[model samples]
Target: MTELLNLFIVFAKIGVCTFGGGYAMVPILERELAEKRGWAESTELLDWYAISQAMPGIIAVNVATFFGCKRRGVIGGIVATLGMVFPSFVIILAIAAVLNNFADVPQVKSAFAGIRACVVVMIITTVLRLWKTSVADRPAIAIFVPIFALSAFTGVPLALLIVASGVAGVAIGAVRQGRGK
Candidate 1:
């Protein structure tokens, strides 16, 4: 019961205060879950973040579900997801009521513009942080560079890229193992 409440509160705070979407929430999530609360290790959090991105639904919500389930169980997943989504639901509803008028307001428009800049910075920070951990060795670099280039230049579907990368990783691992044997 206490754990569930804590999960709800923590995720709710994250959802409410975060100005951008899932990518922008990464740094905050890392700070709270990995550093402050010690709910997960930094590497574990990153792994969950990657998996969440590959799965269906919103990345932040999926991450919350993964963390909650790891901490408590299925019920915790439910609680955390609800907590994360509730704020956006309420805020969007409220905004919908006055969005037409609010959209044209100079102050609101300016605030949104500032927020967009901040969100870009937050996303870049998240990318750098993840890269620090992920790009540790030659194999990782070998896989990452070409995939990045292909995705950037050709706009390959992300799912297909991920699948190809996974297959390559497995093949490389198998070759290494065979060599050792």
Candidate 2:
């Protein structure tokens, strides 16, 4: 189908453009899916991000599958996943083939250093963009602070933190309903 081909091309573009990983893909995903394509809204993309993180795969691939499945069906999911992966597969292969020769070159080293810095900026942009929507109130702040602290400072597992945050949100919502305020 024409739609399927479009989906594949779009995902392939995303795959080629994203650099630092899933977190780094947030801005690009937001722009492409929400701003340009209208396939999903920003909040919906955030939901997909959360759900994908809890699932058993790379976040970008899982998110692509989610988008594809939503757009078409199971087959779309498969196509989108392949589209999202194929570019990275080829790029990594190429990089590996030449890394030994170029790894020590000053220009290559400087370029990688620059990329790492940009990746950090991109990640920060994602956090800032999501911050207003995610930590909007006192209860959210209450949940976020401790979770963030544990994540940054402790050896506590990430899955446990995610679970703890979910539980906290549920409990907070239930208590708020009980008080009727």
- How many times do residue backbones clash in model 2? 0
Give all TM-scores, in the order shown.
0.88, 0.87
Q: lDDT of each model, Cα atoms only?
A: 0.85, 0.85
Kindly list the per-residue Cα lDDT of model 1 for residues 1-181, writing each as its tens digit: 9989999999999998677678678888888898798888878876786677667888888989999899999999999999999898997888898675767899998999998888788778777887878778899899989987997899687668777888988998998999999
lDDT of 2 at 111: 87
Stretches of candidate 2 above 4 Å error? 96-102
Q: Write the per-residue lDDT of candidate 2 for residues 24-105, one digit (tens) a residue.
A: 8888888888889899877777778777777788999999999999899999999999989989898779889876575789
Top candidate, metric lDDT: 2
Evaluated at residue 112, the lDDT of candidate 1 is 91
In the predicted model 2, the residue pairs found to clash are: none
